[model samples]
Target: MEPLIISTRPGVRHHQLDPVGPGLTGRVFAIPLPTTPLLTDALPYVDWSDAYAVLTPLGAPCRDPQEWAEAIFQGPALWVRALFGVRELVVRLVGIEPGGGHAFATVNWRRDEVLVGTDQRHLGFRASVLVEPGRVALSTVVQVRNRRGRGYFALVRRIHPWVVRSMLARASRTMAGPS
Candidate 1:
């Protein structure tokens, strides 16, 4: 998979970047969490947030945001699934719902996006896939409720970018099919 290019500005658009460079094939750009009304209404407060986007190919199999979100959690991103499994075990030991009571996470499907997340005693997180005109953006937001939540998120924040980038790249390629 192509590496993800980190963007400093939250308002940077995918088209603004040069994706035709030597190392940019199937590029996943780390963007700011979109301010779309749907996402804003769904997750009002965000403590920590990250988003990644990729160009929406013509006739891609997963055109809908929900479909892209599903592709990432369902199969395309194998490492994500493995990580979820470990999360399930750890959460279950603490009496939380195993796997957030849904596949990977609790899913709330919407017209242009699908929200997935879980609210635990320590923290709460919401992730969404937004289908824009020419790109698909995946975003995650976390709100820490307590000290433990802050400590937990501290660890996750370090690796969250790499994980989301990989998942976005894998799902994009899987939906786009053969070059």
Candidate 2:
């Protein structure tokens, strides 16, 4: 079977939420997702501020939050912007870890796009994702519907997990390295 790429309400059913760790090795979020246009599932990985402290793989001091955010967020954002026809993307983590021991987490992403020269008269699309780690290696599939069309809007669905996965690997190593 091919890696499932969920970008619709129905697509959510095609995938499963198989986390790598739990009951101590989980995530902690900084900011929470909204109450509308809910994601396929709930992501209790990040925190309320949309920030979290990840353990460096090398067991060194944790890198600056800004560093992590910069490395993690910007990379995927740029990827979507360049690789896909996306206008803007916002990624957030939604879980908690009071102590600090997490293998992976969810990246809630909200992407928007404008439909130009399409069947519709410049439609807009948006969606929320609960990205995690597992079989697909990435969770969260952003889906937008034209408030004016066949329930389908411009889309660049689920394109951040791979970026985040690869990026976090390197970032975790950097953070873990001894200073």
Candidate 3:
């Protein structure tokens, strides 16, 4: 398979970095690789830890969902308990567990698109991958439902583009073979 290249979509927030709706921000990044193989090779293994690996220097806590879940389910480290008193708290803190707490466990898959999201009292987020002719696209739509969500996105907005880019870069590297 050919390596994936990041392509830009017109009117798509990926490279454009624009708001998609009221209090909702979105970005669309293109992948040069074909859709099916890309999803097959990429989605199942993608995770916050993977994103953290690429975006860590940017100051993300980089907590692994499984580790955190384990901390809650089995036994927890003192710090883990202190940081997140309950699993629900962790979800609120982390924006929802990517890959559904397991590899691709919570994804809503379709013929050409895959959607994963979480809605909380303060925020809602939905990320999707749309397969297109000759390329694949990845996008995220985030909605801040309350004051707390607003503050969080405000702090994260500055780095959101970088995080998205790093994620695309990582995906490209992973799917296309390191470049």
Candidate 4:
């Protein structure tokens, strides 16, 4: 399916994907961080943010926000998992805890959202998965603390959106089962 891309502003784009199947369509939005209370409190100053949304069928296996977060972050995407491992190792070397282990356990769960974050000398980041009736949105906000953080995220931001889109798509397909 062809994706419709719209640039809302500098460093922000909205991507709308054609539905692959009934209730299986998805979108990856590189928009500004939302001004919701939870998000604002989570990361006050956002140097970068993006959100990925996927349509969910009723009775989907991973309908809950926390479940969706686990499926997306810890699901059976071997290459993505490897990348996460490398990120963990690199961050640890810089005195940052990368929130290793089960994704669900590492995050903070609220009523309809699951939040995960880490702060270090270089940078700090917060990510959230919000579950609605028939949609799940995964959003991430990052704050660059210094020049090193700026340089590091500059490299990461190039690939971050693609990685998020891939993980969300894979998780949605896995949870949705065969068509």
Candidate 5:
């Protein structure tokens, strides 16, 4: 894949610079690649999928945005990883085409905090991944010292594993499909 061509302007965040975890120092988002484009290739770089599963956890949908936001404010919350199970369609992050043939765009998916590094430094956070078209969401997080001090984290962390496993049960359906 060609080097990701992202625009670099002061305070201008690109698709690669928004998925940053704030206040959740060391907190991670973990995703899995099933040897398919739907999940693995869709990410900027499958390497981003790497993470200490023991320390990182992810879930399907945010049960309560309010509650989930509170936890993120305290630390890092799991990001929803969606994979396409289209038996006939080959899904993967891709660049637009006009003259040159389409090519795969590398996406990183570590602990859900996908980071697409940037060549320029005069822009927004350089971290991102394309979950899907029109449904992509980049993230940025703050680092908090007392991650477990928040009530929301307490509740989610307590059931983080269960939630992740449960969510994994239907990871493909985590998101309500292309909108």
Candidate 6:
């Protein structure tokens, strides 16, 4: 499989929501899998821990939906701690509810996209899939919501592209199984 790339423009599936500034968004052309199954079943199988380890020098992986909920609300503290060996304060914890064919959560209740964070920082991380005749188009969009977010974004911006790509690749490989 080829590498997934992040785009400056919103992905085709990501356009369901209007743009809010130049939020980081991108898509990957997978080997054409069913979008529904990919989201509900296959996505969870992606080796997120390993991927994060490689991508950001962090050990935290969103292993499950509940864990994802916690991680999101807590921001990148867990990953930061794993990388730096120091624990940061938990700024806030938001509630996660079922909606829009995906789990939705928010901090500061800003519009355009959904993510977890406090007033000082807001992040949007969403995953969706669009299936074509033979392959699946996987996409995600990330948005930052505060001044604190700016600093965080600056650090991750360079690697954000690879982060998405590796995540998609891991998920695809998991769906495909051992070669």
Task: Locate the minimum summed-lDDT window of 10 residues in model 2.
Answer: 112-121
For residues 1-179, write the lDDT of model 2, one tens digit per residue.
Answer: 24332223322322222223322222321122233333323332111101122223232343343444334434444553354322222111211112111112223333321111111122221223222221011122222232422222212223333443455444444434454
Shift of residue 16 alpha carbon in model 6, Å: 19
lDDT of 3 by residue, 24-58 (tens): 11122322323343233333222111011112122
Which pairs of residues clash in candidate 6, taking residues 3 or more apart in a chain or in different chains? 32-135, 32-136
- Against the reference, the lDDT scores of all candidates come to 0.66, 0.28, 0.39, 0.66, 0.26, 0.32
lDDT of 5 by residue, 1-179 (tens): 22121333233222221233322312333332223222323323221221111121243332322222222222222342121122113222221111111111223344323433322111111223333222222232111123222332234233433343333223323333332
Superior candidate under lDDT, 4 versus 6 = 4
TM-score of each: 0.73, 0.32, 0.44, 0.71, 0.20, 0.35
Off by more than 4 A, model 6: 1-120
Model 1: how far residue 11 lies from native, Å: 18
Over the stretch 39-87, how does candidate 1's per-residue lDDT look in tens digits? 5655445666667788875554446766677777677466776776687
- Residue-level error in angstroms, candidate 3, position 149: 0.5
Cα lDDT of model 4 by residue, 1-179, tens digit: 45455443355443434323333356444333344556657755666666667777766544566667777877747887778778878877866546556333434677788887777677877778777777777777778898878877877776677788888888777667653
lDDT of 3: 0.39
lDDT by residue for model 6 (1-179), tens: 33333232233122212121221222232222223432333221221111111111122221333332333323333343343222122222232221231223332111222222222234444443332332223344345555655555556555544544444434433433222
The number of the candidate with the highest TM-score is: 1
Model 3 regions lying over 4 Å from their true place: 1-15, 18-107, 177-179
For candidate 5, what is the TM-score? 0.20
- The TM-score of candidate 6 is 0.35
Q: Candidate 6 local accuracy as lDDT?
A: 0.32
Give the Å error, residue 43, model 1. Answer: 3.4
